[model samples]
Target: MTVDPEYASALADGLTIPHYVWGKQVDPLGEIDNITYILLAKDQEEMRLRLLGSATQTMSIILVIVIFVSSTLSTAWRVFRQPRSVVNWCTFVQSSSATMAFGFGITMKLSTACNCRWAIWTASLGQAISGICASIVLVWKAYLAYDRDRRFVWAGIILNLPEPLYLYAAWMHSRTTFTPLGGCTMLYPSWLPWARFGMDGPFNVIFSAAFIVVAARQYRKHGSAVWGSLRNEGTIGLLILTFSNIFCLLLTATNFADEYSMMFWGVDWLITNQILIHQHRPMRRSLHESGRARGRNRNARRHDAETLFHPQPMSPSDKFAQWAELNLLQPKSNSPLASVLEAPEPDISDIGHTPAPNTASHLHSTQASTGYW
Candidate 1:
């Protein structure tokens, strides 16, 4: 007589059992023994959970791809319409790298779905590359916001120069194995996973924190005007990156890589969208100044018109002269001058006053004087 390995394994684990002889109750020493039905049910339930988790990861990857595509198009359109700047070029690089990262992540997820041996290798390599790109973005933003020393930027760049070699090492050391749930999963030496996480995770946290602190300090020192050039979208995106990294660290520490791999894609999506939106919108102060100038011009025009058409009461001499002309300067109806004298004297009380300066020109001068433009 033979027993299923699964049944034997279950029994070895001390799961409850029943003894019987041809459907009749028997002593504890009965030759027929079986694992409880509850054990089989539990195994089925575990499989269901795994399937649900996979489905969730797939949906998340799809959504991330959609967001990446839309944001890339938006950024490209904005770049085409607007004059380029250093910041714009940096934004383009960051967005391009993020899009590549998302693409690789999608590929890794698809490979995993197919239960390919390469899935783990691809996932490891893709995530490493993506992490490197994300780090570059954060470092660049930090340089823009706080670091004055160009050497620091160069140093940071040099630090990441070996990422390709590191990734190659990770791939070379990884091995493929069969797994009941994921199938053909790639397994890294225990030290390798921790080493990768150790290098990437702490740096991610530190960089994110540094970015927030630097931005906040700048905001406090210069007020919101500093952000006029930086854009709120970049600040908000940094915040999102910070929190997402914290979450990713937590998930990785808890050994939930498969359950939360989608977070990597999400971070890239956030970065791409932030760059796109920030580039599309103009600076806030410029918009405000333009509106204010228009308002001032309108008010000036109104005041000038009132002064012209509704001059203050005429002086007594002016009034007397006007009355004398109307009553004493009578002329024969046939005279050519009669038409000129008979016509009501044109009101010229305000004509002597200088014409109001051009309101638009005045406002423009004021803007220049105040540096509002």
Candidate 2:
């Protein structure tokens, strides 16, 4: 029952050790309880490794495909329904590329026909396109937020040019072999397994950093109130892109398994797309409302100015009075006869002359006689 040390070591290292019986090469692991047959520790470990690798790959493939498909559909729907902006178009491109890449990846994982030479080529191409689109999206947003120059955008495109070439080269150079547990397992180059990350990582990080700086500057210059309204629309998408790229880079740097790393990347992209879609709606609504408010304010100011300069028309009675005054048809009465008929007014000359000495004596005698009794 003792296993050979060399066989144990090879098995531990995930190597398939050949079974031998009676000094002849034999499939002893296939036989049961035969005295001439023997199973070594390496065989058991190899089996376990294959099983684990297969399970991991299957799970990863499923997860990536589901996430990519759902995200792609959602993004496509948004792009179709909503007005297209630079950001929207970028999102659409990223989503579409991701969908194709992951879809092809799933086919490769599931189909035996994927062993053909063209499979890897197509897979590499799809992934490269997806990555370039994503990088462009991030850079585009940054440029729009800060630089907004066509030259800068073109420069970004130029910078991303090498990614696809590198991806194809890396994929072509990668080691692909058939395994019993997994149909075809591709072992990429140790130095550059993911060409997308290798080529676009620096650019993605730099542009993301630039976006953060530009967003911060905008927030400071415009104040929190103004920036707060724009946070979801402008800053959040950049933040998501930055963090997702950082996560992918960290996973790659730490030498995490490629299956898990790729799955994580897909999930991150799906979440980013969802966030962008969610943020887009509110941004559009806010913009629409602001435009309406501005229009209403303009109309109100115009109405106020018009009312201030031009008086309102008079009512019917007021118009009649105005017309009468203009035609000199109004009544005027200040004649003495009219005043005497209304109420007589005593004259100052009469008051001074009427009270003569005779009048005064006769008035006094009459008053005394009337009151005598």
Q: What is the C-alpha lDDT of each candidate?
A: 0.51, 0.55
User: How much is the lDDT of residue 238 in candidate 2?
Assistant: 59
TM-score top scorer: 2
lDDT of 2: 0.55
Q: Which digits, one per residue and each the tens of the lDDT, describe model 1 over residues 63-144? A: 7667767766765665675433334444555555555654654554454222232344455565565556555655655554
**lDDT score, candidate 1, position 8:** 51
Instruction: Give the number of colliding residue pairs in candidate 2.
Output: 0
The C-alpha RMSD of each candidate to the native structure, in angstroms, is 21.2, 17.1
Writing each residue's lDDT as its tens digit, candidate 2 over 1-373 gives: 4454524433444445455433533221212111111122237775565556556666766776676677667767776764446566766776677667656555555553333223444555665666666666666656665535576587788888787676655455553333434423444555563454556657766766665565556556655544455654555665666677667666754557544443454555566556555554544343343322322455567889999998788899999889898554543457655455567565677665664568778888988989963
TM-score of 2: 0.53
